[model samples]
Target: MDFCWSPTDPVIALFVPTDADEMQPARVSLIHVPNKEELKKKNLNGVRDCKMFWQSNGEYLAVLFNQFNGTRSTNYQRFAIFGIKDPGIPLEDFELENENDMIIAFSWEPKGQRFAVIHALDQRQNVSFYSVIKSHNRFQFSKLVTLEVEQAGSLHWSPAGRFILVAAMRGCGGDLIFYDVDALATLAIERFVATNIEWSPTGRYVATIRTLSDELDVRQEEFQEGVMIWSFFGVLLYQIPRRHFTQFWWRPRPSPSSCTQEMQDVLEVVNELDIDLDNDLDNVIFFGDVDNEDTSFHIIYRATFHLESTRGLGSVVDRDWTYDE
Candidate 1:
């Protein structure tokens, strides 16, 4: 079972696969969280897998299903869009013009009435943008534009919308393309051998990370595992090399209205503490005075948090530290 919650509403969309031996069709449903009521349900056959994507504002939900053709030994894809806010919860079905073209990635523009799809055919990949258009009292998705992108495998939209990062990660050479939707122009193009890409909550910065796995033997000189921070415009700001790096995450910032007076007071005190990164012995609090080299310690440092003055400012610092498992 696969499920996703609506960002702006108390509705959850779920997809349950079929049991082939039992001859049951796949099912999709939307449930109201408060009342535990099912708002919509649909059953489909020949579906091998299902994926659900909810619009940022909870206006619509798109369910992509991968279907198999046993006779032809081939696969195709189709999608259904559910209108969440509309009465009766109407659904519209759609498929690609060329059903044989495989879909590589899909992403909805944040708080926008558009979505993007990366489809490939015969080793050629293209990114297509579609807008939800309203005409004659009904809404439908209309193709806006399609661009051929080399080795594009994924899409990452900014939190504020308008800008999108098209990247080809893993074995695709980590090709990065920053595009502007409003201007319909390519902002920048760069490359990094990243396994994962993520945008900052404010959409000001993006981090491209290269992580190492325990099972694989990787040459350090060939694939330097680390994190590279870049601006939204595709400019590399900083690159930090970390040995055996496994994961990276951005700290979320709460809204101004949610900030209480007590939280602000604590942040003010935290901002006053000085951080000295150069000296390891100074300004460091050791948990135990054990002289053994294997002993682990927790060190706290004052870091800067990017926020308004009224909200207070502090960030968690990441450093090379040994910890007990």
Candidate 2:
């Protein structure tokens, strides 16, 4: 339930219990809110499929949906990026194409220059890239790449738009593939069972959550669902339970100007093996140099959506413990 705002308009996500239909009538709050906003029948028209991308500046959004007419056709091919000249009035809009199927995944190029779309077409999916180019006294889509993928379950773009991550479902034997967008070379391939995927902001790690374990049904054979943080080369770095797969956030490298020679020395002195990032130990980590006169310590901001709680052996057993008289 991630709520986002595009300039003036705030869009809240609506969930569907069945059919995987985005237009199942959900609510829209005035501003982007994480709380429950039930969709009345009137607001159903504004809700569209999952293929929605907010422009880089957050001034506009591109979405696809069906209209009010009784005679219906394919999903709305083109949608306007919601902008606002007046409060609550959806402003700037640009219609692109009539992509026949549902648009599931999309990426806006870094620096708001272009965007890419991935549409679900049954077992196969369509990958289309677009650039904003001058045409007819306005900008038109310059299709850069139009390709197809098999069993395409997920997609992601590198920060600089240099690559795209594709995950495919091939029954019990599926593959996770990475490709260089420009050179068009296969970067890496992996076989970790994944339910969801996200690339780190710095493009150094690809985080994936295994679906089977998240459901927590032991009777199900594939319930070892876990989260794996992998290097760009497909090497696993950190692994946790699916519930531990929280947000896809990366620590920004501190600028050289902000770091003193002492900070560098401290890092060099601390060996990786000596330091423990043990989740099982259940310790709260605070990363910063309070004594550094010129540096700012990074704050671990806990997202309100998933406020994590501490767990202990006693905490677990106490809840289920009982005394026999």
Highest lDDT scorer: 1
Clashing pairs in 1: none
**lDDT of candidate 1 over 44-150, digit per residue (tens):** 77886798888888998999998877663777899998888887887888777778889889999998889999999997888888888865545788887788887
Stretches > 4 Å off in candidate 2: 1-4, 7-52, 68-70, 73-75, 81-99, 135-137, 168-174, 214-224, 227-229, 233-325
Runs in model 1 lying further than 4 Å from the true structure: 19-24, 69-72, 213-219, 266-325
Error of 1 at 95 (Å): 2.1
Q: Give the TM-score of candidate 2.
A: 0.52
What TM-score, to 2 decimals, does candidate 1 have?
Answer: 0.77
Candidate 1: count of backbone clashes, pairs at least 3 residues apart or interchain:
0
Top candidate (TM-score):
1
